[model samples]
Target: MPEQVKLRDGTDTWVLALEPSDRERLVAGFEELSDESRRQRFLAPVSRLSEAMLDHLIDDVDGVDHVALVLFAEGPPHVYDPVAIARIVRYPDLPDAADLAVTVKDDWHGRGVASALLPVVIRRRPEGVTRILTEVASDNPASLAMLRRLGPTKISNTTPGVWDIEVDLTAHDLPQPIPLAVVPPEELDGKRLHPVLDAPGRHALRTRDLICPWLN
Candidate 1:
């Protein structure tokens, strides 16, 4: 679920929400992102999301409930657009403090975007989310290094060159995090917004997609 939020970073941060209506654009951008050879080397394919799917997800996305942050960077005058960024998705079966999955644009790598977002995520760390988690391809040293800088994280091999890492947010005195807008508000002017929705089995379906056809 996406939410409209304002964040204070000793400065100010405004994050726009990704409502259901933005499904096609969001999914399209995600597809484009995944298509990047650079990103493909590290991650798996992301299945194109449909409007109906988005509706189901957002309808039940309560802030402290099942929420996902779609972060993007902004331009001057507070224009929110794609930010080289990260996101947190909360799963009911998983531990409380949701796990984080981040992707920094190749061009923005090492520019402090990940660092900036981490503290915010830690601050807005959900009430029950004490630990944040993410998976990095074994070969991705840069990501591993950044994760290390964040704090204490448990590492376990998921596959030959893939690993799952969990970061303890409580130990880190991080500031509140806000969702960054990937699309501008003025652009959303008259777009039809759908109720956030997804198939109950879509997650499982995604797993199949990852191993079988493999969206990555």
Candidate 2:
């Protein structure tokens, strides 16, 4: 079943796991994001999601024992910054513990979209996730303040306009706890180390495919 959270506005925001059915809505929301909003929310430029790209993201979702939550706007998804979209992925590996990402539409900023979305993330922080990491452009004081309110742990300047920050998730101050579980690698075989024995044909295939393409 998909996870969901109800906003204070009496509307419901659904957090669907990364799946094929959810890709269209996700891509549409991402494409609708304005450039300025994209700059503020992301660390880089993000064009609209293509089917292939969506497939790759979904694949990543399955590879990790992590959950990706989509914030719904009255049953629809919303867009965040393009450059910083990876913030969601990095959330799972934070120095502290938390499994949450915050993203807001450009036109929706200062309108409580981020504020409304934060609690949902806090509630969803994994069991042992007592520390959260975030990066905000130094010029973007508003974002820094938002993250600080969650709890000020550490701040380091990455660039003139970017600051990396961390938030601690001690239960005394917060509600949820992150589960202590680590996903292990799927394989550890000699075939992986001794590639020639496992797949001698692969070497010929690579040489034929790449060597001829370069020659042509």
Candidate 3:
């Protein structure tokens, strides 16, 4: 079942795991992309979705290895229009990482559709997969912001206008709060501590020079 949600513009929508039967929606989605949009998205001249490409996108999906979350236009469940799709497919050699790809119908640009759908797919990615890899065109601020918003990123490849980066998803796994260190007593054995611990400013540090403030 698709999960009900709303875009940043308050437009109602739903998302589901992409299915092989959703081939028509995939075709329509790709068909709607302008040439520039296609280039920005696929990083090459992708005028059409080749049969092999379609097969891979359609058939190679599994919730674990090739996770995809497909967003639909506002409509009933049975009748649907797929407005966007985000996929995270694990690398065969790098099991801990996956290549991230996201596409939105050209008409839906600037509506916060990808912003809403991207993190969900990343969060839904398998446990062992702690890194996400992708390329974003320098001019495509939308896609760049989408990836950066999810986790800490590092540029792993130097492409002229296109950025090949890796996202450290584990950074999102914040550590459990542990008790802070016990504050050091000002006096050790009834004398000021060495350096008085971390003194405030220059004056404080100067006053803290002695291990213990013993009279000369």
lDDT tens per residue, model 2, 16-56: 43454544555555655676555555444545444545554
Candidate 2, position 77, lDDT: 49
Q: Which prediction has more favorable TM-score, 1 or 2?
A: 1
Question: Taking the tens digit of each residue's C-alpha lDDT, what string does model 1 give over 105-194?
Answer: 444455565566555555555567766555566666666666666665556554455555666655645333222133234433432121
lDDT tens digits, residues 1-216, model 3? Answer: 568778987778777887777666566656556788777766666666666666567676768787778787664545556677777777656678777777777677789888788767877886699887655666776676677666765542244566555677878453332211221332112322122112353221111100110001
Question: Rank by TM-score, descending?
Answer: 3, 1, 2
* Candidate 3 similarity to native, TM-score: 0.73
lDDT measured at residue 157 in model 1 versus the true structure, 0 to 100: 55
The list of candidate 3 runs beyond 4 A from truth reads 75-80, 173-216
Which candidate number maximizes TM-score? 3
Measure candidate 3: CA RMSD: 20.9
* C-alpha positional error of residue 76 in candidate 2 after TM-score superposition, expressed in Å: 13
Where is model 1 more than 4 Å wrong at Cα? 1-14, 34-42, 50-60, 70-80, 172-216
How many angstroms is residue 58 displaced in model 3 relative to the true structure, after the best TM-score fit? 0.8
